[model samples]
Target: MRHRFGRRVCITVISVGALLSSPAVPAVAEGAVPASAANGSGPGYSDDATLRGKIISRLQHMTVQEKVGQLFVVEVYGQDASTVSPTMAARNRALYGVDTPAQVIDKYKPGGVIYFDSRRGPDNVQDPRQIATLSNGLQTAALSQRQPIPLLISTDQEGGAVVFRLVAPATAMPGNMALGAGRSVTDAHRSAEVIGTELAAVGINQNYAPVADVNVNPANPVIGVRSVGEDPELVSNMVAAQVNGYHDGGVATVAKHFPGHGDTATDSHFGLPEVTHTREQLEAIDLPPFRAAIAQGVDTIMTAHVVLRSVDPSGAPATMSQPILTGLLREEMGYDGLIVTDALDMQGATSTYPPNVAPVEAFKAGADQLVLAPQMDVAYTAVLDAVGSGEISMRRLDESVYRILRLKMTRGLFKDPFVNVELAAKVVGASDHLRDEQLITDHTTTLVKNDSDVLPLTRDPQRVLVTGWGVTTTTTLGNAIGRRGQTVTVLETGTTPSQTRINQVVADAAHSDLVVVSTMNAASVNPITGLPTASAAAQQALVKALLATGKPVVVSGMRNPYDISYFTEAPTYLATYGYTAASMESLTRVLFGEVNPVGKLPVTIPHANGSGALYPFGHGLRYDG
Candidate 1:
């Protein structure tokens, strides 16, 4: 109940006690919780006197402007500042409203800079070398300032579902849901460790990863495949494994979307998601995994933008709610780890307030760092003005900067913040990493539904018709599928296919001895659902068309596991979690009886025609070898 004084705090209290008799907590009902609920005695809360002394020492050398700068961690191109022309900087200023990544550091004096996939320098040049050089320059700029603090260059390197943003050049691992399906804590650790090496190799010290959200809602358009599974305990255990792996690989970890991003049907990226679950329900379900994450000693906790009505009756986003951030996470949960807000650029956090004031509000709400505020200049000005006018206390500002600097010190940034540009190029995307990535995909390639016992697919490669959406027609999986002296008519379906177009492909299925189709159907609400909805529909239509031909269709949901709900009549079905080349190779090996699939379904595969699951969470089939 510390920091619980405002009307906001009262509303949160109401939410916590709103339904005491509610069935939200069976464990609480069964007397599973400890007597102490709101005490700040947890492992993540740093009462380390020495660390506090170091933070105090660091604070003594900083000015008010410097202290304010330390509270912001905004976006930047992870490239050298020298390479950027003044004209390009102006263009970026005009386009993105920032002078330059380095200039922003010089002016705003931010604590960190998050990297993204953008054209570095004036030209559209992209490479790992640019990333390393840019990081070195950003750190150098930080150190050369009045207060020589190293910049914490961070990225969203959550290795799951897809090879996205910064980690594209590195080895592609099977994502979180796939890792859960494989059901190996060892694999989860190894996968994160491998990703960490790649991240560190490129000079990224902090990784916003190991999504702790349990995918309890399949219609949850954003967190669906990104989450490990729907089960809380299972997600908790996997989150711990990932934290260990990140540490093992020497990367600072941030276990994110705290409290939980699961169970919400809307995507926070597009707009605010209204979470109506009672506090009891959240404690029993969503809160446990985060509690587990804290026990694992996570470095940072990122807040979700979603509004939990139970926590705030006025429906404030968690990032801007003192009740959620300080009351729940900091006091009740006993987590003193750095509280970083999710990008203030998202609609979920911005819909209620003018986007420009996010930085000030986020800090007031208890967040240590303002992350990725798109309106950086306006937000930075807001913070400066607030601190100057006494709207925000100077002491409070120092506390956040202390945490930020302490994290930098913990990352060994003060001593050796720079990476060897050459070493970065050599170590990043290492050849050996591919072997590890392949192993992950091999284990994660789940055979979700094989009702016809047609897996360990017959090796007769005589004119096999291979059709898929999302993946290229001919890749490692396609090549391997036809390796047994057979020709494959690779038919690639467009993401937006006309029904007539799907009909044509179905008509062409007559010439082939066997038909195999792969569809990517995992759903996430990016503030709006129907991500590739048309493609899912087309794939379903293609399958139904093939079914009409009596061609004994073999189907694989290369991305989403829920695809089995759409193509229920398939004699054979598979869910590979990801559509990567590595996953495709694993599917090929499984098809030829070279590898036995031990993968389980991470989330429940809902029945296509209804609300129930065709195969529940943790369901997977085996071949009688």
Candidate 2:
């Protein structure tokens, strides 16, 4: 295994222009020959030669079209093929020859592929083993067509509400906020190792995680619970530890939403968000974690579509800004690993730049990969034209390609690109999964308030009313409560519930002895501003109703702890750190007095009037009585 600093030096020297401008390609002296003459036996073509050589030689032979295709990452929801329209399929086939996994692999040959939770097996049969089998099968089919360069398989397994390991046998880890509560870098490292080990078992080499953004803005819509915490230095340490953990487990990590999305009030998924901060301020607060990750040799950095006017005065977002990507991240911060643009389909990038031009601009701006292009042909062609026309040098393309190949080589992708289905099945659902889940559950339960000795809900409560938005029949919290109490009523609210639902919740609270209200913000935000709009005034309204009942209202925040201000009057409040099943289960255990809440609040919760009276970064109330 490569030491973190050693890997960083190797990637940086070769990737950051020192070797790009060298008179001779590094492999030429090592006996690299043309592909046709060598019969794949050239110095650069053999497996004996560092895997990097084979990748470089293959890339050297690739036409502009093929090279551009290498930079494009297509989004395939699942093996079903129905999620993508036939028309779109036909278009992909026509443009990049994307049809069967082999055709797509042999034709467009993307550097990576990203999967969502929807790609897992069918509803009833979904399990980590099933996911591993399906993923390995798909990857194998792609490799069988042509000489395979290891395809980077990635997923958003950030744990908590954003878990893909939903089925039985696969364990869920707590979110970053929960890890933050432990206030131990070792805890963060353990969490990363657990997630990395599971993902690696299933052939997922890349995890889009260790959200580097500092959760400074209380109202940040999407990044609340996902962030590690508000302090830049602490987040930096945690991010570094997480990266080290992943690397230790042979899983690549991508520190995301770069240039800092923490202080912004809007979410970038919907539109572009403007970060109104001086360059110095951003450097001090927002960019510290990312800088730390880069310093720790993180494998990749994903750009955010956030506009930082101070950094790039042209109003260009970081995803499309040369100043931010090439100048700041690469030149200033010394990050030479793969630079990936966030999904092109996102409104933040798509709305600003023309569809065909965005990918090209992204490459020119220093991104090595373009994710989820709407039209591969137009995007690929634009990049090819840029390279051929010298708008972006072939050296630049080579630089990016080399770094990507190095990563593949590091992963031993060239030696064995295929996965053993049976072995994967056994490892995917191994005992380690369950153990890690339990550890995270135990670590995330935070006891915010236990005033008046109203905990452990004595034996069984006669009437328990639980109400919250984002809760449903399948919700783990509700199920846990149902198991413990005889009469448990759960009220579900929509994203933004109507007044009628609020009134109904108020009426339901009247007869309940113990009322638990949960609030969640999906963290989806306005793409341009990065601020979140609280959906459903229900949290604010439910507090008033629960206060009227004169009973202990236990308020739990499923998302970010910032929402606690809406229910400050509640005698007992807890922050589960996230909404994952593990979190919910742990929270239930705490509520019923089955477990003590040892975790502290990672982020502060302000007063309802936004007076900044929120619980400070490391505040947790423990019951001594």
Using all chains and alpha carbons, the TM-scores for the candidates as numbered come to 0.88, 0.84
Model 1 worst lDDT run, 10 consecutive residues: 25-34
What C-alpha lDDT, on a 0 to 100 scale, does residue 435 get in candidate 1? Answer: 85
Error of 2 at 217 (Å): 0.9
lDDT tens digits, residue span 157-265, model 1: 7876453555546677778888888888999999899888777876788888878887777777778778888888888888899988987887888887976889887
Worst 10 residues of 2 by lDDT: 19-28
Tens-place lDDT digits, model 2, residues 75-175: 55334322344644564455455544344555466777776644342221256665566566656655653345668878777766654434445556777
In every candidate, how many clashes are there? 9, 16
lDDT of 2 at 80: 33
Return the top candidate by TM-score: 1
- Cα lDDT over the full model 2: 0.69
